[model samples]
Target: MGFDARFLELHAAMPRVSEADAATSVELDYVHFSVVLDTARRLARVTGVNVDGASLVELDRGGDDWQLDERIPADWQAGPAVYARNDLDRGHLVRRRDPVWGSPEVAARANAETFRYPNAAPQASGFNQSKELWLGLEDHVLAHASVNGMRLSVFTAPILAAGDPAYRGIRVPLRYWKIAAWNSGGELAAAGFVVDQAPLVDTSEARTPLPGEVPDLGPFRTFQVPVADVAALTKLEMPELVEADRLPKTIAAAGWRRLETSADLLL
Candidate 1:
C-alpha cells in the first residue's frame, strides 16, 4: 500500500527548476516533477477570497491531519531571516495533509513568511481549509506514478493574492501542495498551490527577510499529469476568462504559470 513504485524506482527527472527561477523565471535547479500555477490561479480567482472574514491562522494547521511532513531544507537557514513578531504564518506550498509528505519539523519550517508584512494578503478560509481536497489531488497522482509522474514542491513564501483587501496587489508563491484529479480520463493536474497575492503593499522591494527569518526553499508549486504527457502545463484561466485568456499570459507575467508551460519533461 505504499506509493507507486515508479515514484521510488524511476530516475529522478532533470533539475529543470530552482527555488529562485519560480520567483523570477521558469528556470529551476531540480526537477522531480512539473507545475502549473495558472489553473490554481483560475480556481482562486473564481473562488475568490471569500473566507467569510476569518483569518488564515484560524484555519486548521492540519493538526496532524495529513500523512506527510514538510521537510525543512538547509537552504532556509541560508536565506533572509523572517521576523516572528509579524503575523505571517510559515505557509507551505505542499500541504502536510498529503499522505506522501516528507519530514515534520522541516515541514513546520516550510511556513508562509507572513511574519513579514511585505507578504501579507487576504485569502479565503476555504482555500486554507480545503486541505482535504488538496491532499486528494496528491493522493491520486502519487498512487500511479509513471513516465509522466511528478511530485509537488514543499517550498513556501509570502503572498499578495486577491482575497486580501490590504495587500491588494501582492502575490506570494508557496511550496504547499495537495494532489488533484480532474477526471476518469488520463489527464492530471500540473499544479497544486495557487499564487495567493493578497491586496496589501506598495514597496518596490521584493519580500526580504526580517530580523530573525531566513530564505526558505519551502514555498513552491506542484503538478500532476499522465504517465506520458511531456508538454508543459500551459497557463489556464478562470471559467470567466477561459476563452479570452487561454494562456493566462497576465498570470505568467505576474508570477503564475501552468503545467503546460512545459510537459512532464522536468529536465
Candidate 2:
C-alpha cells in the first residue's frame, strides 16, 4: 500500500531515512507503517507505525482476531503457530486503539489493519500490570492533547537484536521501545520509553522448565529514556524526533528515568 502523505504531516519531521536492510514497507489505510522482516529470524527488523490522535474513536476493543497481510508472502511473517504453545503474547506494534478513531467505517478498517501479523511482535504475556501501564503511555499524552491541538504520532517496535533467543523458528526480542511525538505550543515534542521483557522470556532452546517451578517471570520494567538512544538502537532516521524529546538536554548525562506509573512520565 502507498503511504499517505498527510500521515507525514501528523508526525514529527524527519531526515530522509536510508532504506533498512532487506526491508518491506506495508502502508495501511489510516495507519502508515513499514515492515522489515528478517526472513531467517522469522521476525520484523522494525515495524514503524504513525498514528493520528485526532482521528481516533472510543470504540470497544475489537475481537482479538489476527491475520497475515496478503501483500507479503505468508511465510515472511510469523504466524499463530509460533505463539501457540508459548507464554509470548502477539503484542501490537501499532497500538490497537490509536488508529481506531475517525468515521465508523474508517475506524473499523483501521482496527482490523492492526491485527495483521506484520504489526505484531512476541512479548512476555506475564507482564500484565506493566503492560497496562505501557499501553496507557499515550493516554497520558492524549490527556494533554486538548490543550495542544489533539495532534499526536507514536513510533514503536521491538528491539530486534541479532543475539535474541530462537524459539519455534522465531527469535523473541528481549526489549521493545516506543516514542510518542506531538505538538506542544506549535513546537514538536516527543518522549521515548523502553519495555524490557528479558526477565520474562526463557530464550533457551530447551523450553521445558524443571518440575514444580513457578511459571511467572516478572515484574517487567519500563523506563523513559532519551530519544537519541532509541534511534541508536533501532538505527532508524529519528533526528527530528530526538530533538523533540521532552527530557532535559542533560538527560543523557544522567540516565534513563525508571517509570513505575504514568504519573512518572514527563508528557
Candidate 3:
C-alpha cells in the first residue's frame, strides 16, 4: 500500500533527500504513495505516487478533512496552525486523485490518505487560477498514457530552498517541482515541470509579519523544465528520470519553457 518503484516498466525509484538532511527525514507510506518528511523544516522533502488512469475511481471530496499522521510527531508536520486565518491553501503534492485507483475500498483509503498533513504544502489561495494550467498538465499526460496502457509514476515536492521565508515557525517554499513518467513504446518517457509563486509572494512581509499578518501571494508562473534542472534545483538524485526526459536538448538549452496551455507541452 505504498509507492511502488516497479510500478512502471522501467523502475523510477523515489527521490532521496541529501545526506545532511537524511537523518532527520521520516519516510511515511500511505495507501498508494509515500512522503519523505523533512522533520527540521516541518514539511515534505519529496513524495511519489503511482497512477493507473484507466482504473481511476471518481470519489467525492465532500469531507475534505486534514489530519496529522500519528506515526510521526505532530510537530514534524506543518499542521492547521500554519494555514489558519491565512491565504495559504494546503496543496497536495501527490495530487489527491492521482492514487485513487483499484477496488472501491482501496480507492477510498487512497482518497482519505491524501488529506494527511505530510502530503500538503502551503500555496497561495489565488494561485489556483494560474494553477489550472499546471494541473491540466497532469490530465494531459494521463490522457497520453491512456493510449499506452494508462499507467504513470509521478514524483513531486517543494524546492525547500534555504532562503524561503519563515512564517508560523515553518518556511514557505516559493517553488514546486513535478515529474511524470510513463512507458512509451517499451521505453521510459518523462516530462518535468517547475511552478513558481515567488512573484506573487511578498516574502518581506512574511519574514517580519505583524501579529496577525500573513504573506501576501498572487498568481503563479508555470514552466516546463528539464529533468536535470529539477534535480539541480531540489538537490535530489534522479539520473534515471533525467536520462528519460522527453524535452528536446535544444529547447532545454534555450531555457525553461513557459506554458500558457497544454498545447505548449513538448510531450
Candidate 4:
C-alpha cells in the first residue's frame, strides 16, 4: 500500500519529495502516491504515482469506472462534470498499461485504480504530433527494457502553475512532466521529459467556457529536458534522480532534444 518495494527496486532507490504541499499520502492497490489537495482549485497540485514495471502484465483496454477516491473528501478532487463539454481529456498520470502486469486478479484491481478521479488530470482534449510523442515515450522505453530485464519506475504529474488558465473552477495546466528510471547493468539511469500543450490551450481570460470543445492550436512540442530542470520547474527534490540522468550535465550546451518519435529519445 505504501510506495511499493517493487518500485524502489526498479528506481534503484527512492528519489526526493517533489511537492511541499503534499498533505495526503494515499496508497492504491498497486501504486503508492501522495497528493496535495488544492482546496481552492478543487484539484491536486501534485499527484505522484510510483509504478513497478515488473508487476505489469498486458494493457487492459476494458471499460473503466471513474470514481472519486473515497479515501479523501470528494471536493478535494475533480469530478466528471469538469470535463463535460470541455475540450479536455481525463488523462491518467499512471499510464493504464504500466500497472496491469501482474496476476489476472491483481492486475484487474490495479487497472480499476487507474481510473479514480484523483489519479486523473485535465489534458488538452485531443492529440497532436507532440502529444502522440509524449504518450508513446513509455512504450519506447519498455521496448528497450527488454534488454534491461523489462524493468522501470516512473513519476508523473501535471505542472501546476499559478498562471494556468482557469476554467469551470479548475486551472488547466499547460504542461506535464514525466521521469522514468530503470536499472541497467547494476546502475541507475533515468530520463526526464516535458510536453507543452500551450499551443492548443487558450489562456485568454475573456474566452467563453465550452466544456466539450478544445481549440486546435496546432502541433504540440515534446522535449527531453534535464532532470535537474524538471526538479526545479516542478519543485520536486530529485537530487539522486537528477544525478542519474544519461543526458550531459550541460543539457543546454547540447540543447534539449525535440522528440518526434521513440527513435529520437536519448534513452
Task: Give lDDT tens digits, candidate 2, residues 1-267.
Answer: 322323544445422234764344333333454555555555655554555666667776668899987876788788888778556688888788776766788778777887888778887775466678888888887884432656566677777787666666666787888887776776777889998876555557435434433233345588999998988887777788887788886765689888887777776
Best by TM-score: 3
User: How well does model 2 score by local distance difference test?
Assistant: 0.69
Instruction: Provide the RMSD of all predictions against the true structure, rounded to 1 decimal.
Output: 14.1, 4.2, 2.1, 3.6
Query: Which tens-of-lDDT digit does each residue in 214-263 have in candidate 1?
Result: 32223223333221111122122222112112123444344433332223
- Model 2 error, position 196 (Å): 0.3
Which lDDT tens digits does candidate 4 get at residues 146-252? Answer: 32666676677777788776666677777888888877777778888988877654547445446634433335689998888888887767777788887776654
- What are the models' TM-scores? 0.29, 0.83, 0.94, 0.83
* Shift in Å, residue 155, candidate 4: 0.4
Model 1, 132: alpha-carbon shift in Å? 7.0
Better of 3 and 4 by lDDT: 3
> Which candidate model has the greater lDDT, 2 or 4?
2
**The candidate that achieves the highest lDDT relative to the unseen native structure:** 3
| Global fold similarity of model 2 (TM-score) | 0.83
